[model samples]
Target: MEDIRIRYYSKTGNTKKIAEYIANELNLKALSIDQNDYNSPCGLLFLGGAPYANIMSSKLREYANNLIKENVKAVALFTTSNWSRRTVRALKKILREKNILVYDEFLYVHMLAVNGAIEKTKLFVKNILEKYKG
Candidate 1:
């Protein structure tokens, strides 16, 4: 995984499931942002969270802010929402302020079936790989 880390905060388990799928598929470590040692790794970071009222959870925001003092090379974000980019923009603002490079974003809306979410995540992963592939 080369220091790639997947961290997420889930309120209803949906975001957690998405994070786990991405981590497992990519053979990387998946952890909760609340973990005691959830520091930004060196290579890449995948941060996920559930949006509430068009805003990211406080835990995610705090972690993003903390990245300013870390040495992470790049970051990507994934979220489970009902169709809003406000959360993404808000978090991007924080990362941008710290001059962190945001590679891409994935948004998986809450669906009744798991297949839809899984497929979307797979596509998101593919896109990320293609975008970052050099």
Candidate 2:
């Protein structure tokens, strides 16, 4: 089994908390999207962020645009928004241009508490593990 990494972009720490919770649940390393090494040999990634001004975070948007030679095969996008699907749509469009498949399990927490994030992450991870493991 190849390693799956968790990467996120956050400003008010909401996305960071969700990312960390997911990473802990899956026992995977969580890195800031800015700090992710494009050369790393990861099978898939859980990319997360919080919407800023109703758009994807600038740094994360840039990172997704710049992805070229990475070994990542797929991504599961997670986000926290008041109630907008535009973030996922924007990210999906970007990833489509790069030819990276976005997993069907794209998750978004509607501005949740830390414990809420953890619980949601647990359910998401469980489904992902089952899909990949099966």
**Which runs of model 1 end up more than 4 angstroms from their true locations?**
36-40, 111-115
RMSD of each: 2.2, 1.9
For candidate 1, the 10 contiguous residues with the lowest summed lDDT are 106-115
State the C-alpha lDDT per candidate.
0.74, 0.78
Provide the lDDT at 107 for model 1: 58
User: Candidate 1 lDDT, tens digit per residue, 1-134?
Assistant: 67677888888787788888888779886889887344535667777776787778888888878875367777778877666666667777888888888875655556344446777888887777666664
Per-residue CA lDDT of model 2 for 25-120, tens digit only, reads 877678898785766767778888777778887888887787653677777888887787677788888888888877777778887555567777
Which runs in model 2 stand beyond 4 Å of their true positions? none
Superposition error at 77 for model 2 (Å): 0.8
